[model samples]
Target: MRNIKIVIEYDGTKYKGWQRLGDSDNTVQHKIETVLSKMAGENIEITASGRTDAGVHATNQVANFRIDAEMPTHKMRSYCYEYLPDDIVVKTVEEVDLNFHARYNAKVKKYVYNICNNKAHNVFNRKYEYHIPQPLNVEKMRKAAGYLIGEHDFQSFTTLKTKKKSTVRNIYTINIVNEDGNVEISIQGNGFMKNMVRLIVGTLVEVGLGERPADGINDILDKKERKYSGHIAPAKGLFLEEVNY
Candidate 1:
């Protein structure tokens, strides 16, 4: 068997999420698997580096699957492009080592959240960005984000109630870029719990809106409770930017 790795990009507007749902067929994973399974003439299962919630876009989502077919990687990629929806595209495909597991070998993941900071919403990117009409204190938001960088238990940021084996994650960097009427929050981390990045963005939004203080992030981390964090930001604004191995 040959392990094939593919880099994918998807709009995620019409799909439920990356993972397949039992009751729903509108999922990115199911869509790709169906086409690949048909090509391989067998049931095919692909493992993604991580899952993106519904309405979240992805620019460089990575996944790998083993196929018995000896078709050229480029041919497989062309087949995917021919069969997949217009919104989802297989960007690159290559034969990989059998030991390369996308999820287990991921070293870093980068996510970006886009915000429209003007009173007027961006009609072109409305479905891809979050609209915040109120003026945000960008400097304050940056200050709050500074406290979140480094290794720490992020239980307070995730909505999951069940205990994870380890909530501790190392955030390598958090960048907040403010342009004219637009803001982008980019975060790079080793790993993330469910809703962790969105929750961090929500807390920073509160700081930017003056609802929460910049220094309050420290207290929230110490508490390790979800209620102490701000609201979960909308999923539409988030994008899976890259996965580094």
Candidate 2:
């Protein structure tokens, strides 16, 4: 058996999410697996670096699958591109070590949240960016993000219903940048719990909008309480940008 690794890009607006839901077929993984199974004449299961929430996009999402077929990796990639929807594309494919696992081998994942910080929304990017009518103080947002850069218990920034035993994560960086009317908050971390990135963005948004103090993140980190953090940002604005191995 040969293990194939693929780099993919997808606009998650039309699908439920990346993972296959048993009840629903509208998922990126299900779609890709179906196409691969048809080509290989066997059931093919692909493992991703991580799951992106519904309506969240990805630029370089990585996945690996093993197949007994002797087809070249490029042919397999082409076959997927030929069958998958236009919104999903397999950018590159290559053979890898048999034991290479996408999720387990991931060292760092980078996520970016886009915000339209103007009075009126940009029609061109309505589906991709979050529109915030209220003015934002980018400087304040940057300052608040600094408090989240180190390792800490991120229980306050994730769903309280998570089944994971540990909520601790190390954030390598959190950068807030503004260009024109678009504000991008990019974060790199070792791992994330469910809704953690969106919740962190929401908390920073509150600080940018003057609803919370610039140092509010410190308080949230110290308290480790979900109630103190801002609401979870909408899923549409978040993107799984890169996964570093």
Candidate 3:
């Protein structure tokens, strides 16, 4: 058997998420697995780098599966793309050593949240960005984001529904960039809890709107109370940018 690594990009507007569920009718992983299973003429299980929440998109999501067939890695993309749906595209595929596991080998993950700060939401971009009409103080948001850029117990930033045993994670970078009427926040980290990025963005939005002081972010972290933090931003704004191994 050979381990096959596939890079995928998808518009997560229609699917249920990355992971395959028994009851769910649609999922990115299910679609890819179905296509690969048919192509290989056997049951094939695919594993992703991580699970993205519903409505969250991805530009470079990685996954790996083992296949008994001997096919050229360069031709794998063409074969999968021909069978996969339009919403999810297999960007590239490579045959790697059997020991290279997608999820276990991931070292860093980068996520980007897009905000449309305009009076009127663009119909074209509505599916991809979170539209916030109120003007945001980008400088204040930047200041608030700095507080989250280190190892911390991010209990305040995660959803109460998260079942993860550990909430502590290391955030290597939090970058906010404003161009025209769009604000993009890019976060790089070792791992993240459920809703962590959305909650962090929501808290920063509150700070940008002057509802929460920039320095208040530190207090929230110290409090470790989810109720004290801002609301979870919409999942559509979040994108899995890249996965580093």
Candidate 4:
């Protein structure tokens, strides 16, 4: 058997998320696995670098799986592309060592939340960007984001239904960039709790709208109370940008 790693990009507008759910009808994983199993002529399981929530897109999601076929690694991309849907594409494929588990070996994951701050939405970007009509205070948003960088217990920023035992995670960077009526919040971390990025973005939006003081972010972190934070932003705005190993 040979282990293969693949870089994937997908539009999550219609799917149920990345994982293969028993009861759910469609998923990114299930779509890819269906094509892969047909090509390999056997049952195959694909593991992702991370599990993105429903409606969350990905630009460089990675996954790995093993197969008994001796096909050349370079040809694997062509084979999968022929069978996969238009919204999902295999960017690259490479043979890797057996021990290269995509999830456990991931060193860092980078995500970006995009907001279209203009009065009118662009029809071209409707599916990818979130439209927020209110004007935002960029400086205040930056200040709030500054407090989120570094290691902290992010229970307050995550959903209450999170199943992870430990809520402690290290955030290497949180950058808020505003350019020409577009606001992008990029966050890089070792790992993230469920809905953590969306919640963080929501809190910063409150700060940008002057509803929450810039310093309130620090207080919220200290309190570790979910109720003190802002609402979770829509998943359509979030994108898994890349995974570093």
lDDT by candidate, in order shown: 0.94, 0.92, 0.91, 0.90
Cα lDDT tens digits, model 2, 140-181, are 999999989989999888885765588899999998889987
Task: Please identify model 3 stretches exceeding 4 Å from their true place.
Answer: 20-22, 160-164
Task: Report the lDDT tens digits of candidate 3 across residue range 156-215.
Answer: 988856555888899999999999879999999999887899999999999988998999
- Sort every candidate by TM-score, greatest first: 1, 2, 4, 3
Off by over 4 Å in 1: none
Clashes of each: 0, 0, 0, 0
How many clashing pairs does model 1 include? 0
Sort by lDDT, best first: what order? 1, 2, 3, 4
Model 4 worst lDDT window (10 residues): 158-167
Worst 10-residue lDDT window, candidate 3: 158-167
| TM-score: the better of candidates 1 and 3 | 1
Model 1 Cα shift for residue 123 (angstroms): 0.3
Q: How many clashes in candidate 2?
A: 0
Residue 239's lDDT within candidate 1 is 93
Is candidate 1 or 2 superior in TM-score? 1
